[model samples]
Target chain A: MAKGPNVNWLPVKDDNRPVNLDLTKFHFPLPAITSILHRISGVLIFVGTAVLMWLLAESLSSEEGFQRVGEWLQSPIVKFIVWGILSGLLYHLIAGLRHLLMDAGIGETLEGGRRGAVLIIVFSVISILIAGVWVW
Target chain B: MVSRVSGATNLGRNGLHDWVLQRFSAIVLAIYTLGLLGWFAVNPDFSYGAWRGLFDATWMKIATLAAIIALCAHAWIGMWTIATDYLTSLALGKAATFVRLLFQAGCVILIFTYLVWGVQILWGL
Candidate 1:
């Protein structure tokens, strides 16, 4: 029989003491950063979906409704908002695909996960730039 | 030494289901988004007629409805996870958890309303 490494098992201690820690001083790794941004992007997309649904409903209602949405899209502020929404969508989509790939066991290793995160950021930035040009 | 309980309840048993649904919805939304963007790119002059014509197709209407449903599912799970993970507060007792549940429920109602409204708009009914 093959020998295995020894393990140490410790008994649990009852401790309800409060521990103060500063989150601002913490350093986030690439994968952690990507994961947090994915959550943030999901929230952004959720809010943006509301706005998009409203626009779709308005545009599909009648000719006047369509014209109203068309006119609204012509404003610079509206365009900016659209750009922001698109950027969020792009990043979310890319990072989300990475997550899916990870789920499929493609990037399960630490090194692979880091590389995937970097690729997500790079690709998303390029896509967002393209979306900005298209929107404006 | 503290006594350890072997049969402690698992908090994350249902999380796996939500995780799978989120990923599934994400795939659907991604395809719909890319397809919509491609349609827009190919047809630069997006007039009212063009918009109406696109949605008038039965297939397009069905796809759009599916996408909307997927979006709702995806958003609900995402928001629910975020709320549960970040809304805990020791000082506020269970207030944070209560508020988180309320917000999630509100979001579900809003999303369902939008989904119904979107379908009506798509079919012009």
Candidate 2:
């Protein structure tokens, strides 16, 4: 890692808190980054809801409408979008479950929270990739 | 430990509600998605009457209705929590809440209405 001159990475203690200067002063920590991603996933789900609903409506309308939707879905572009939506759904589900588990008094501690956040990302990526395989 | 009891209780209640529905809806959606894809694969030229007939099965109608309702509610609760977390302004959060409630209500009504209409179609009403 390249650091500019006069950069002092020190383990400074504040009050009784252990300050890992590399983590605190340099950049956002893993847990904070995952927390932000959780919010982003939620927003993605909100937007994807409209697309899924539109597809459902079209499919259920009539035979022609069904065919139309099917044909539209057959296109590679639409298929990719469908895959993207499903991936988003899978990721959101994993992240949401992580939050739920945290709420259940499971991972509120600093170390526990960090581990859980990493697990959320790992699970989300795996589930989303599985969904992508099924969709695409 | 003692002071956190109340907060823990609240968290458990809310998280359990969302978690249970999310799992329940995912199960239904998994079945529904497979069924839909299979139907399309088997019958390429699926017609209106055929479509009606497919949905005419009592269990199929009920299952699909259940899926739609669960999906809507699960999505609603999930999205609501997300909105509340992100939107700091009280007015914006309230407005978002109102809109989410309306959307959820509309989704339920639409699904139930469609189910009833399908029943009518099956019964020649």
Candidate 3:
């Protein structure tokens, strides 16, 4: 919270005129931030899918290939990228669950939704940290 | 409001259909992910032999195939939703529709390739 971006994405006055609408000057609410983060994590995992597919295909190709994959996991940079993708997957999974819950009529209120968003942040950080440990 | 101009191009030509498919595919994907995590936990130091054995099973192959299909469907809907949400006339001006369709066509081809490639990888196992 020390240094934050400065922008209001879609601020409008009572008359529906633009208040700021500057991308950099956006003031993000917790809910909005969480929602955007969900979108971001989904896109990240989507882009990383090709790498994942390649890894799967290679690892299953032969004994030598499988051993190579295991060894690749030992590399620090490979481990980092794996962890990043895992983090994105886990975040998307968690946020997607929240969306499902909302669709099912749970936490549908403004206040309840805020609480859900807060819970998502807490859970995602803890889960991502745990996944990091597991990956490394 | 979300745009409906591109609705006809959506999967099944129905928002509810896309919505249901998205959620269904999501559940399948989540289950598949959790299943992998469970396998990892059980294997601890899973060797190449053990890993191959896991996928070599008929059940596991079926599960993997199902997961890949769900992944493609889930991704298609998600990408389409993102495009319609942002790649619009309101944001991208007059050429938005053209640009969006081009982007979407790319997505479709990529997803289809993933689907075919995934099936090949799995069944060839």
Q: What total of clashing residue pairs does each candidate reach? A: 0, 0, 9
Can you list the residue pairs that collide in candidate 3?
A: A6-A24, A6-A25, A6-A26, A7-A24, A7-A25, A7-A26, A7-A27, A8-A25, A8-A26
- Over the true interface, candidate 1 deviates by an RMSD, in Å, of 7.1
Q: State which candidate, 1 or 2, has the greater DockQ.
A: 1
Candidate 3 lDDT tens digits, B1-125: 22555785577558889999999999999999989988887888888889889989989989999998999899889888888888866577777788898988998998898899998888866
lDDT for position B60 in model 1: 93
CA lDDT of A31 in candidate 2?
86
Sort the candidates on lDDT, descending order: 3, 1, 2
* Candidate 2 vs 3: which has more DockQ: 3
Docking class of 1: acceptable
What TM-score does chain A reach in every model? 0.82, 0.74, 0.84
| lDDT score, candidate 3, position A111 | 99
Q: What is the TM-score of chain B alone in each candidate?
A: 0.82, 0.60, 0.92
Better of 1 and 2 by lDDT: 1
DockQ-based class of model 3:
acceptable
User: What are the per-residue Cα lDDT tens digits for candidate 2 across A1-136?
Assistant: 3432321222342344343434336677888888777666655755665676677566666677778887897789998988877776666666666766776788889999889888988887887776666655
Candidate 2, which CAPRI tier? incorrect
Model 2, B1-125: lDDT tens digits are: 21232123221256677667766675675567667767866886667677767776887767777766665655555555554443322234335445544554564465455445444433432
lDDT of 3 by residue, A16-121 (tens): 3334544567788899999998888888898888889988999999999998888999999999998999999988999999999999999999998999999999
